[model samples]
Target: MVKEGLLDILKGNFLVSDEASKNWRFLLFASVLAALMIASSHQADKKVHHIADLTQQVKTLKSTQVKHKREIQQLLLESRLKEELAPIGLGVPEQPPAKIQIVSQP
Candidate 1:
């Protein structure tokens, strides 16, 4: 009888047997785990793409920052400032600057 039952199970006839009813909960749990694994994999892929996009944005912003900083440094040079001021008739004085000390009344 036991050999006949084992043969029945091996022949894909276990679902019609009493053991299938007893293992319904295990089957349900396995299905849920499989669904969760699929969801987790999709979420991981989304995060990877998001990180790549952010990394590219950072690189673009860094290059822009470097370019702006170079432009600002070039504009702030003494020769550049003098040239710009000359157009406004504001050239630096040739005479040495004098300092005046104030004396307070006693």
Candidate 2:
């Protein structure tokens, strides 16, 4: 049965026959749709993997940003600066700073 069907397909008998021609067209359409579905699935998988990679990179960048932010916050602390400056004998001034005004000659 299968061999006869293959022989009929090879001899183009299906194209000339009314019932077989409809089946042939339907099979061809189905095959094309299957191919497109496979291609679309592959493309979707590629995009999913790309999005996963980007998500991981975003997480890494966020962690790095957080670490830098924490470091900056620690560095900006007055107690931390005071401790760091103790060796140099630098301390906050007790007096308010004076403003200096310069007069330009005309």
Candidate 3:
């Protein structure tokens, strides 16, 4: 009996035999599992690519921020401020500022 079953499988007879109906549910289940596995793999690949893109964007933003910070530092320098204000007729005071004191009556 076992030899006949093996021969039936090798001859592709089992696929057309009446017993093949019993295997249809299991075959459908396996097919669905394979489809889900393929979909999961594709989703993981997309997430990896998205993360790489986000990482590159973060690096670009960081470099741009550093450049802007350097420009702001240069603009904040006293020499640079004086040079910019000089063109507008503004000059530094030569004498020190004075303060007045008032006495309160008791």
* Candidate 1 lDDT score at position 27: 74
Ranking by lDDT: 2, 3, 1
Q: Please give the lDDT score for candidate 3.
A: 0.91
Which candidate number maximizes TM-score?
3
Work out the TM-score per prediction. 0.79, 0.64, 0.81
Give the range where candidate 3 is weakest over 10 consecutive residues by summed lDDT. 14-23
lDDT of 3 by residue, 1-106 (tens): 9999899879988667788876777788899999999999999999999999999999999999999999999999999999999999896788887888899999
Candidate 1 Cα RMSD (Å): 3.0
Model 2, C-alpha of 101: deviation from truth (Å): 12
Clash number for each model: 0, 0, 0
Higher-lDDT candidate of 1 and 2: 2
lDDT tens digits, residue span 1-106, model 1? 9998789868968666577875677778889999999999999999999999999999999999999999999999999999999988997799989999999999
- Pairs of residues at least 3 apart in sequence or in different chains that clash in candidate 2: none
lDDT for 9 in candidate 2 is 85
Best by lDDT: 2
Clashing pairs in 3: none
